[model samples]
Target: MKCPLCGCEKAHKHGKTSKGGQRYLCPHCKKTFTDTFDTIYYRRHLNTDEVHSILQSHTEGSSLRGISRITQRAYGTVVSLVRAASQKAQIVHNAKVQKIKTKEVIGNEMWSFVEKNKKPVSQKN
Candidate 1:
């Protein structure tokens, strides 16, 4: 497998992670990494399905406590999962969407901010 960090093509299976994921050793970087490395699931004990379920529930607008109850995970774990997922999504977005050509772009929140900050106009008698 090609090492993501060093782009080395001569990596080999070094070992298995505690969660039974295959580990690879990068000959060039002299580092060990797993399939989940550089992903939201990296260094996390949760399996692929568990992380998927958490993200699915989060996308469904489930509250943190609700997700914790639904996934049978701790409240903190739910929060961390959402946080990690968002960070990974941001990284993927930045990588994939390199350029955008647009004349003008505005968001709903920006309009609200402008409306809220508008100066008051005095009434004419």
Candidate 2:
């Protein structure tokens, strides 16, 4: 596969790790790449399953520390991946929303949550 970052079509298999993971070196950029490149776990040195777990935890509202305990990864790494993924998701969501016609509306919790918390509801005895 081509290197997405530098669009290099030439890549060499550096070596396989103990986990049977293959590493690639991009000839054009001279940068080490892997299957996780341009993904949430890029540069994190994590396996595909662990990367999926991290993303799942983040999407489910788990904190970085929480994900660290579950995935056995550093909290900083979890935070970094979550932040990048969140930004990417937001961009995709905005683009999708923009493409929707006036007849089609998508509901998100941010607006409802703010409205609900903004004022206290009064109960009549």
**Against the true structure, whose lDDT is highest?**
1
lDDT of 2 at 23: 84
Q: Write the per-residue lDDT of candidate 2 for residues 1-125, one digit (tens) a residue.
A: 68777888888898865556678888888887667666666555776788778887666777667888988888778767666777777888888856455876677542111112356678889
lDDT of each: 0.80, 0.71
Clashing pairs in 1: none
Q: Can you write out model 1's per-residue Cα lDDT over 1-125, one digit (the tens) per residue? A: 99989999999999888777799999899999998888888888788899999888777667778888988899778778787777787798789977789989874321101122477898999
Candidate 2 residues lying further than 4 Å off, grouped into runs, are: 17-20, 61-75, 91-98, 109-125
Using all chains and alpha carbons, the TM-scores for the candidates as numbered come to: 0.74, 0.55
Error of 1 at 31 (Å): 1.0
For candidate 2, give the lDDT of residue 99: 46
CA error at residue 57 for candidate 2, angstroms? 3.9
Residue 117, model 2: lDDT of: 31
